[model samples]
Target: MSQDIHRITQATLDKLREEHHHLTTVGRTEIARVIEAARSLGDLSENGDYHAAKDEQGKMEARIRQIDTVIRNHEIVERDGEATEVSYASIVAVVYDG
Candidate 1:
């Protein structure tokens, strides 16, 4: 399988790394705390807070994995000069999926 490519600047890379680190460390710790607190409250079958915390934890983990993939397989492109050749890929494609 081919690896997905992501061209990013150093600053962007640094920011992504920071976010990943924060989520993995402090964020994970906080979620675990919430889950523990929720678990202490009666039955596990009808624990809404516990389920919600688990759901949030899953989403957060997915995000961390996404950031990890980019960090692992991405390339840093330094733009030092003006563009000489214009092609279809030369134009930046901005799509708002949200």
Candidate 2:
């Protein structure tokens, strides 16, 4: 992952933290349960369910790592409500003549 710092809102950061918690806890447990169930289904080489569960687990772990990186490398920012110019996290809209 890039080492560049991310500027994110406190709300966004909180949401990310919540997601990280869920993935590390409930998500991991659920995937493990699925894998165990799949493992009992017979031959490992022919078990499509086992392979699919493993693949899903890998993807979830990757996302957890990504969220962890962002949570670690981010700078929390608040919107400048009084500012007259567009800035970081500012919503923008445009209109043009057709």
Q: Candidate 2, residues 1-98: lDDT per residue as tens digits?
A: 56989999999999999999999999999999999999999998999999999999999999999998898899988888877899888887898989
lDDT of each: 0.88, 0.94
Candidate achieving the largest TM-score: 2
TM-score of each: 0.79, 0.90
- Which portions of model 2 miss their true places by more than 4 Å? none
For model 1, state the Cα shift of residue 84 in Å. 8.0
lDDT of 1 by residue, 1-98 (tens): 88889888787899999999999999999999999999999798999999999999999999999999999988887654566664322545568998
Off by over 4 Å in 1: 80-98
